[model samples]
Target: MDYSHVRGVDPAVADALEGEVDRQQNTLAMIASENHVSEAVMQAQGSALTNKYAEGYPGERYYAGCEFANDVELLAIDRAKELWGAEHVNVQPHSGTQANMGVYLAMLDPGDKILSLELSHGGHLSHGHPANFTGKTYDVEQYEVDPETGYIDYETLAEQAEAFDPDIVVSGYSAYPRAVDWERIQDVAESVDAYHLADIAHITGLVAAGVHPSPVGVADFVTGSTHKTIRAGRGGIIMCGEEHAKAIDNAVFPGAQGGPLMHNVAGKAVGFNEALQPEFTEYAERTVANARALADTFSQHGLEVVSGGTDNHLVLVDLRPSHPDTTGKDVEEALEEAGIVLNANTVPGETRSAFNPSGIRAGTPALTTRGFDEEATREVGELIVRIVDDYDDQETIDAVAEDVQALCDAHPLYD
Candidate 1:
């Protein structure tokens, strides 16, 4: 993590980079979409490949001297195919949103209909939020989780799909904690003769480790970020059946992006190789177990754990039932001050604005990556509850900060 070269060039940027490394070492990162990549992956990402410009897929690159870039990209594609059992894989697209964009460009026209989960109820902005390009290009409708149970209402979704008659139906989520029924969603999509795009950006590693169900063979298109649950560097991937391979590739390259980030592709290669080992399975299982423990602790302490508990790496807590006066932002800031990091998230049937939502979302991926177990996660959950109970109490926050630093010390991150 030394920044000596950067310091020699520019002291200001070097200081910031060094400070960031120190911050990660000292705090707990509970953000659902974040994880610590292995040193191998990080080094690969920071490699000299960043200087290259390989404009196309492996062997068919438009530029000369792309031999090593071709090798790295091919290795990444092959590893991803093996990991997800997909017939075809595209390791281009700068991000998960771009991956989705690739799909829409390939299969949809402007003003085509899109059916997806509501953002507040566990959907992503790329699916169809008005602020994003997808919303501007497509005519969109949304489904939601059951108000009482806090779970996706499949029946309602089917009904919505029937009425909307969308050209595509999206199946994955960001904030929801329960397992998705991909086949059921596929059935609805099929009934309407619509394409199904499953975005597993948040659970790519979990699916690779067989901890979560995969949508590779079931959905018409599968898209994800290489980073979140996976230790891959920051990039996106798209997978589909062999029939649509050419279209996806062209859409990603000529349609959406120019040159692929070969350094990131190299990182994905290293991380995918790491994930292929048996230990990754244990890590995935422990991650889910830790989240369950966290959810149980929150519930036992009287917080309204959304959907009762979690089957994945995150737990969504609705603050209205237990602490109506407290906002998610309040808890979020207090926890950050206490060295615990998570996000203020909108919940199902949200009553507050998106900026100051009524729920908090926390996950165990980064913590689990740091060697945390169920017991350790439970302690972290207890500390979260303490902040939620008395966010304005500086003394309690100071005490929690001490305990959090001790936890960080016990489970050191980098060298």
Candidate 2:
């Protein structure tokens, strides 16, 4: 078979790769869940470690030639424990979903009740989505944020926890804008005698950088992605209290699947090391500042920001009032035409389908990492607002997109 065309390694593919790089270099990426990994992390991911496949934990590899691989993996685990203040760490899961699954398989029995935040109110599908393993394997109960305030209603959640009597209480969110009340969640989990699992996938970097409160002391288990604000390779991590260390390790390894991605683990170690640097703290802090600046700009332009505003790296903008008949899809398309990249998210109480949501989700982590600040964020925010407000004006939108490209050029990624 002539597999040359399928492999995408020829001239056409090379052009495509360059085009994608150009796109990233030119566009303002505001997806809250995405980030730009560092050169060191990238180097580690593409290193010689990719050749090895040690099918078990460090120092117990099935393969004979894994001495160096063991060292890298063990270093990643140790750094993760120190960074998050966990008694033990597992840096092997392929993704955030897999990390959560490992925890469930380790502790909970089939049909045991698991309480988590409602998906629409800012929770990951892996927490309890009906189509996910979490919902299929367990008796799932959900708590939601206040519809009006867009913040978690702690009192309401406490009442639900009291009523459901779940075996595990999950604390985490995908689109939440405000800080989580970890103390309250810990108290509730303690009262119910439920194990508390905090999935700090979105805020782990902030927590590590001290911009957000650490969930380590509050939750019995904490899981996070090495990506997002951490700016590492795409992988999951499980950090646990001493009591659950053995169970957590068993769940991640023999309980879940076999083998770990040695390459990604190496990248994770580099990212963890980078995160400990003074510059990374400044980067994380700037991410928060940029988010707030963008949110303030939106409010000034009369766009209704979900939860009123943000204290972190992302903001969910409610577009219902500004463009009554318009969907987030329309605004997203308009902005894309203007070279501004972001996701259309479903706001709480959204009547629209997930495919065409009523809200636009924007963040500043990528931009801040690219050296953007308050002024750049404000300019970007105004451009976003203008496009959404006058979505029908193609010429104006394109003109503003020109401005966006200019700004992106001034502050290039990984420069």
Candidate 3:
């Protein structure tokens, strides 16, 4: 963790780097899309492979002296295949969004139709938000979760799919909590002669550990991040059957990006190896159990838990019903001051702007990695409720900060 070499060259940047380590060690990280990677993975990502410029897949490189690069990438691909049971996997995209872009490029031409969940309802921007390239390039339509139950209405989605007749049907979500029936969505896409792309970026680890349903063999294409719940390298991955493998490979290489980040690919190989152990299954199960405990604690306090609970690692809490005057941004800032860190998110049927939405999203991935169980997670949830109930009270914030520090000390990170 020492940055002495960096300090010798650039003290300012080194100070910032060291400060970030201190921050993560002190505060609770409840951001649903984040996790703590092992120092082994970090070392791999910071290795000499970062300088390599391998522009093609293994055994066919666009540059010389790429033997080590090929070895790392091949290991990543093999480990990913074993982890997810994917027939074919591409671990080259720089991010999850780029993986989605690769799929879009490989399958559809410009102005093709795309049907995905609406962003405020738990969909990602790459799916079809106006601010992103996908919205500008394609004709996009969106589906929604049932307003009353906070779950995807498959029948309604099928009806919309039949009517819209999109080129691709996008399943999976960023915030919606219940298990998705991938078969139902696949059937809907098949009925309309459309391809199905399942974006499981947030639940990649859960799916790999058999804690959540997977879309590898069921969907035409699957995309995920290596970081989130997977706790791997900071990168994206794409998986498909052999029939579409060549197209995906080409789209990701010459179509979207040039050179692969070999250092990150090495990190992926190391982390995937770590995930294959028996301990990872236990980790995944505990992550979901901790989330359920957090949601139950929220419900006992009269806070509205989206979908009434969670099946995975995150719980979405809508504050509109219980605390009508409090914005999500208000609670998020106050919690940060209390040494708890999560994000403001838009809930289904959102009545406010995205910047200051009505909901807060919390997850147990980082805390679980730090050895937290159900009891500790519930205690954290109670602390969150305290902040939500009296966010502006400085004395309450101070008390919660002390409690959060105690928790951090008990579950020491990077020790």
What is the TM-score of each predicted model, taking all chains together? 0.99, 0.96, 1.00
lDDT of 2: 0.89
Candidate 3: give its CA RMSD in angstroms: 0.5
Candidate 3 lDDT score at position 97: 97
Local lDDT at 375 for model 1: 96
Report clash pairs, candidate 2: none
Off by over 4 Å in 3: none
lDDT of 1 by residue, 1-415 (tens): 8899999999999999999999999999999999999999999999999999999888898999999999999899999999999999999888999999999999999999999988999999999999999999999998999878889888889999999999999989999999988999999999999999999999999999999998889999999999999879788999999999999999998999999999999999999999999999999999999999999999999999899998898999999999999999999999999999999999989999999999999999999999999999999998999999999999999999999999999999997
lDDT of 2 by residue, 1-415 (tens): 1334434657677667667778888888888988888878987997898899888887777889999999999889888877778788989999999999999999999999999988877899999989899999999999888889899988888889999999999998899999988899999999899999999999989998889988897899899999999988779999887888889888988789787889999999999988878898999999999999999999999999998999889999888977778889998988888999898888888888988999989989899988998998999998998898888898889889899989988998845
Error of 2 at 374 (Å): 0.7
Ranked by lDDT, the better of candidates 1 and 2 is 1
Q: Write the per-residue lDDT of candidate 3 for residues 290-355, one digit (tens) a residue.
A: 999999999999999999999999999999999999999999999999999999999999999999
Candidate 2 regions exceeding 4 Å error are: 1-9
| Cα RMSD (angstroms) for every candidate in the order listed | 0.6, 2.8, 0.5
Best by lDDT: 3
